[model samples]
Every structure is written in C-alpha cells, then in structure tokens.
Target: MSFTLHKKEKLKSKKLIEQLFAEGKSVSNYPVKLIYLKTVHDDGSKIKTGVTASKRNFKSAVNRNRIKRLMRECYRLNKPLIFNNIVGDYAFMFLYLGKDMPTYEHLEATFKLLFKKLIIKENHEKLN
Candidate 1:
C-alpha cells in the first residue's frame, strides 16, 4: 500500500454515522471504541474514517480536540494494518471513552490491540 494521505478517505454525513452505530459492531477495550461497517461505495479502495471524543467525557473543547488529535495521529500511523484487512470500501468511527487522555505509548499500544481485535472480529462476523 502507498500509505499516502492522498488515499485517505473522509466519512461524512449524519446518516452514515448513525447507520454504522446502529447496525455495525463495536469493539471496545476502554479508552477506545471502534465502530465499523463494510459500506458499498463506487470506489472500493476508499477507506473512510471519522474520529470523535465525547463531550460528556471532557467538557473542554481543548480536551476533546486533544483526544481527537491523538486518535487521528494513531490512525494515520497505523492505518496500513487496517487497510490490508478491509475487503472493500468501509466506514469507521473511533471514539474516545477514557475519562482522561493517556500517553502516546498507552494510546499506541491500546490502539494496536484494538485494531488487531477488530480484524479478528470482522472475520468472525463474516463467517456468520
């Protein structure tokens, strides 16, 4: 894979988010929630993603923004692993669930674990 930002896709639209939340499966191990669904877009190579930090967890915009930044950075760095497993165009949302932000190491390790689990979960779901 190129691992270029040019191939990075954006997941927009309220309906898509809601559908992913309602119908897709979530993998959570504290501090992070991965919600994903295989979406049929015209372009199968696109992998659209969205990041969110709940306002309920952190009222301050700075805190929320910080968490989002961390999530995006981790995703940008580690997305190749995810891209490899995706069968087609997909939409994903990463939500921060921790009360306080963790260190980069903590986030990176946890994010890696989460993605690994997600790949397993996706395979399990596909068989059913």
Candidate 2:
C-alpha cells in the first residue's frame, strides 16, 4: 500500500457533495461532523472525499477557505489509513463544526482520530 495522493481521491463536484449531504448518515464527535454515504461504481477502486467549513461560524470567505484548505490537507495526509482499512468504496463529506480555526497539529490529530473511528465502524459493520 503506497499512500499516493491521487486526483481521483478528491471530491470536487458540488452537486455530488450536496447529494451526499442530503442522503448520507452523519456522525458527530465534537469539532467535526462526518456525512458519509456508500456509493457504487463499476470502478470502485478508490474513495472520494470533500470538506466544508460553515459560513455561519466564520463569516469571512478567507477564513472559510483557509479552514477548508487545511482540512483538505489534513485529510489528504490521513486518508490513506481509511483506504487501506476499508474493503469497499465510500464517498465522504466532512464538515468542520468548530467556532475557531485549528492549528495543523490539532487538525491532523482530529483527522486521524476520525478516520480511525470510521475504520472501527466499518469493521464492526462487517462483523454483523
């Protein structure tokens, strides 16, 4: 498992992200909320993900963009754990719920923790 950051792993479509938000089940664990839906594709070889920071919290576009960029970077670095652990494909939307912007260390730790929780959820489901 080479943790290569690839273009296909990025979730870029607004419509798809919104659809996932509308149809997906969410899990919240303070400061971060995850909205995920199982997706089917003939080429189900990779996972795609998106991140958002609420305007209601940061009113400034600069702040929101900065938060989103940080979240993406954190996810990019941490997501290979999920890719290696899960057996199948999934589409994930992560929303930042904190009132203040987090430092890189905080974001990275939270991202890894969330991914680990997700892997545990996936494993638990498989055992059922």
Candidate 3:
C-alpha cells in the first residue's frame, strides 16, 4: 500500500466522531492521547483517522493549525505501524494534550508506542 494519507482515510462523519469520543477506548502516553473504536467502513482501508489541536491550549488558529500540521505529518508517516498489524477496521482520533508545541521526533516516537499499544489492545479484544 502507498504511504499516502488519502482523503478517504479520514474520519468525517459527525455521528461516528461523536460515538468515538463518547464510547471509544482511549490510551495516553503523555502529550498524546489516542482514542479508537473498532469500526468498519465501505472503503477498503483498515484505519480512518482524525486529528485535533485544542483551541483551549492554543487560542490562535495559526498555532492550532501548525500543531495539527505537525501531528498529521507524523501520523501520515508512521500510521502503517498499526495498519500492518491489525485485522479489522478502526477509527482513531489522535489528540494533542501537551502544553507546548512538540518536536516531530517526540511526536513520532509517541506515535510508534501508541500504535503498539493499539495492536495489543486489538489483540486482547479479539480474544475476549
């Protein structure tokens, strides 16, 4: 599969987003919190992702956009870690919870760890 973050891979349904935040399981590793739900889509992708940078922390749109830019790029580059390991569909929201902007290296490392946790999480779910 190509390593491109395609438009179809984005989570855009308001209802699905609401359900995700309301009932999805969440895992955090400092500065980042990953909320995910086991969900299927008509599209053939294994993962659908959404990203956020809270307005409460960074009041300006530019700052929020920049943080989102960094996070999306980090996720785009590293998402296959989870995609290659999972068996079913999943919707993920990667929330930035840090007080300050993080370097790409920090975010990338956290993302790798996060995907590993998600793999373990999915495995446990399958067994249960």
Best by lDDT: 3
Cα TM-score per model: 0.89, 0.86, 0.94
The candidate, 1 or 3, that scores higher on TM-score is 3
Off by over 4 Å in 1: 6-8, 43-45
**In candidate 2, where is summed lDDT lowest over 10 consecutive residues?**
38-47
Question: Please, what is the whole-model Cα lDDT of each candidate in the order they appear?
Answer: 0.83, 0.81, 0.88
Candidate 1 C-alpha lDDT tens digits along 1-128 = 66454443767768988999999878886889888888876545467888999898899999898888888888888888888885667888998889987788788888899999988988887899
**RMSD (CA, Å), each prediction:** 1.8, 2.0, 1.1
Q: Highest TM-score among the candidates is held by which one?
A: 3
Q: What's the residue-level lDDT of 31 in candidate 3?
A: 92
lDDT order, best first, reads: 3, 1, 2
What lDDT does model 1 reach? 0.83
Please write out the lDDT profile of model 2 over residues 50-88, one tens digit for every residue.
788999999999999998888888887777788778876
Model 3 Cα lDDT, one tens digit per residue, 1-128: 56799999998999999999999999888799999998888889778899998999999999889888888998898877877888888899999999898899998898888888888977897899
Candidate 2 deviant stretches above 4 angstroms: 1-5, 42-45
User: Which window of 10 residues has the lowest lDDT sum in candidate 3?
Assistant: 79-88
